[model samples]
Target: MIKTAILVDGAFYRKRAYTLFGDISPAERAKELSAYCHRHIKDEKEGACLYRVFYYDCPPMNKQVYHPLLKRAINLGQSEDYVWANDFFKELKHQRKFALRLGRLAEEQAHFNIKPDVMKKILSGVKTIDELEEKDFSLSVTQKGVDMRIGVDISSLSFKKQVDRIILISGDSDFVPAAKNARREGIDFILDPMRSPIRDDLYEHIDGIRTKAPKLEKQNVT
Candidate 1:
């Protein structure tokens, strides 16, 4: 059997899951993620075996920051998002053959910004800036060390021959270099974008493209 390592971009998976599967409890989400990973291993054509599942993500921000729309400082640690994220991470740790690679949020650079759609409306004169509300804004923060960690792991896996196949679950082109290197080492590199459209050029870098999970109907717009 071909040993396969499944690498997940946590932010991308979470967004896609929310869009396709709607809101679910953290424990349920973890179980779903494990099932999704296992589906790839059970592919009869590849005869893949489970090596490990590496999930890369940043811990939730737990700092106090001033909200421009609210005109007050908000403690992010007390937010429901923070609580849910912690719970989700805890649940993931309990899964077999699962490895969590946590990066960190650039807390000092964290700030609230208008949502992209809201900003577009304002710029196009469809909505006035004076009409902006708290709901139109969202906290923006940069994720540090995530891409680097992924790159390093890919290099290590390739050099050490830990797995014959590397299946990355991300849509970002930033991983092109790592994927190229892994392929050079004779590892079967596959890209799983979770049904999201990828650039035409991206096909040249991977051995295959596969998404085992079925997309569910979106229940709500959040």
Candidate 2:
């Protein structure tokens, strides 16, 4: 039987899981994700044996900063969110045949900008910044080098022939070249979009698609 490997895009899976399961703890989320990966592969095995699972993401920044929402400088490292994320990583590390590939986050100076409509209302003397929601302006940080690490790993795995099939759990189109290369190397490439829509062009690179059922959106509002 051919060996199959699974690669997870941690950020994407986390967001989709929240939409599916709601505001759950990281440990619970990890548990469900682990089951999903294994179950999905087993269902799609087509006579292949499970190889290993790889998860790629950057670590939390957990830095202290003053924000418009909090109105004070706070240490994110001391926050509940950081604690949960650390715990989640630990859980994954302990899982069988699971590898965690971590990337570093780079910080930059940024300021929250007022929305265009909010600015127009202010210019017309109809509203003020304080009248708007704090969420309207958010301080943002970007992840660096994560994509490169994923691409390099894909290339390495394909070239080394560690597994005959590779299952990538991501929606990013950046993996196109690597996927094409792997296909040329006679690897059976499959994609799992977490029940998300796949692009038209992406259909050319993969052998098959599989995903868990996404929860239906609740639209009723009181």
Question: What total of clashing residue pairs does each candidate reach?
Answer: 0, 0
The C-alpha RMSD in Å for every predicted model, in order, reads: 2.1, 3.8
**Against the true structure, what is each candidate's TM-score?**
0.94, 0.84
Which parts of model 2 are misplaced by more than 4 Å? 69-71, 109-128, 135-139, 218-222
| Candidate 1: Cα lDDT at 86 | 98
Model 2 lDDT tens row, 48-79: 67788889887776777677655777676897
Ten consecutive residues with minimal summed lDDT in candidate 2? 213-222
Give the distance in Å from residue 212's predicted Cα in candidate 1 to where it truly belongs: 2.1
- Candidate with top TM-score is 1
In model 2, the Cα lDDT at residue 54 comes to 89
| lDDT digits (tens) for residues 1-222 of candidate 1 | 899999999999998888767799999999999998999888748587989999999999999999998889999999999999999999999999999999999999999999999999999999997899988999999999999999999989999999999999998999999999999999999999988878999999999898975765455433
